[model samples]
Target: MTKSLEGRVALITGASRGLGREIAQRLAQDGASVALLDRKAHWAEDLVAEIESTGGKAVALGSDVSDRKALTAAFESAVSALGRLDIVVNNAMWTKYAAIEDIDEESLDRMLGVGVAGIIWGTQAAAAAMRQQGGGSIVNIASVSARLGLPQAMVYCGIKAAVEGMTRSAAIELAPAGIRVNAVAPSTVATEGVRAMLDEATFEARVASTPLGRLGATSDIAEAVLFFADPMRSGFVTGQSLLVDGGISVALR
Candidate 1:
């Protein structure tokens, strides 16, 4: 309501639903016009419509974040429509739970393509636009899996770890250009995607392991993202991975 982000423009990937959607909504509520990007064009359209219905300005773009050309076009279109790009949230990811031995080449390729390469390409494209605007913030969505390795999430863990590394390195490179890069790592968020994969027993076990004795919600992660995107709040922060995992990372092994 205070409109801290008034006149700012934001682009969010995988914003059709889940954490990405929550992040987009929160940013829009803070008065930033948003571009919702997703592989599912219809989902993007619906999200944009919802936001606009609520008196928020938004545009929907369909593009694969991992595809350089497509992502470039989407980023350019968003900036062209919104007038400038102030924030970019790289939240798209292809994740699956499988044992290391069960993971085949195809699965691995898809995971890395969306998880790792998507972040790399999105960050670079957003940074270029931000540079032109004199500066901006890039928020990469990572996972607690990177810190607390799960048995069936080996590839996902590896991809998130790579994202953290990239965030740090890109922050350093982009600092001189006035662009800030950071990441948010959440654990076992109760999104539809996670709920579908985890049973109540497993979910409870996870919560018990967390120091907070609870699982994370989409809003929990979105709040951290909002903080990082706010120049006034996190202007001095960059190249850092903020964990929004209900203290799961601190649980004793």
Candidate 2:
């Protein structure tokens, strides 16, 4: 019996935790040999072990996404280890919240460095591998902040918007090579980091705004990514951003 991703290899940045972790696990379960890239090497290693224990194939790569050379090398190493790269997910990002007036240079630079530059480098490296392998899919983890005005998150908003724009441009350029580029924009998800950051009131308000009346689960976003990552599911989809926000993007605020 052939699996959905049988014989395919996938590389996912930020695979140590949260949505990235789930995405990596999902891909592996679907039968892809997953390369888990994360700055926290130990975490990725642990996840890789867990996946392997479940009869899935996975490898951990500790590489800083912000470093173009390191990221490029990591992509190559993934290919060498996994055999070939067919799916790439640019999910690593850095963010620091500050009001527009309080925004600082360092924070902005770091956010853009990882969110923007990292995606660019990842796309470049993956395109090179995928073009050689015949074709591939790339999924950028964007955010609803890119489409909505969020106070104290201007930098994050801008960075995500940039990612969405890049997704479209890359799709157009890579289409000729049979490479597909797309993005998944998720709203506030109930991850450990988010739960720690949002107080009760704020959290409830966010959930209330969503038609689903609940925060997104890691699996929700992971399923959306799987859709984009599989050619059989999204063969004709490209240059588009799917909002996995449970109708929040449409609810009148």
| Number of clashes recorded per candidate | 0, 0
lDDT of 2 at 149: 89
Model 2 spans > 4 angstroms off: none
Residue clash pairs of candidate 1: none
**After superposition, which runs of candidate 1 have C-alpha atoms over 4 Å from their true positions?**
none
**Candidate 1 overall lDDT versus native:** 0.91
- Native-to-model Cα distance after best TM-score fit, residue 192 in candidate 1, in Å: 1.2
Candidate models: Cα lDDT each = 0.91, 0.93
Could you tell me which residue pairs clash in candidate 2? none
lDDT by residue (tens digit), candidate 2, 94-178: 8799988999989888898899999999999999999997899999999998999898998899999999999999999999999
Model 1, span 1-253: residue lDDT tens: 4788999999999999999999999999999999999996688787888889999999999998879899999999999999999999999988777987899898898999899889988988898899997999999999888888689888999999999999999999999999999999998898998888889899788878888877898999988999999999999999999989877787674
Q: TM-score of every model?
A: 0.97, 0.98
How does model 2 fare in lDDT?
A: 0.93
The alpha-carbon root-mean-square deviation between model 1 and the true structure, to one decimal in Å, is 1.0
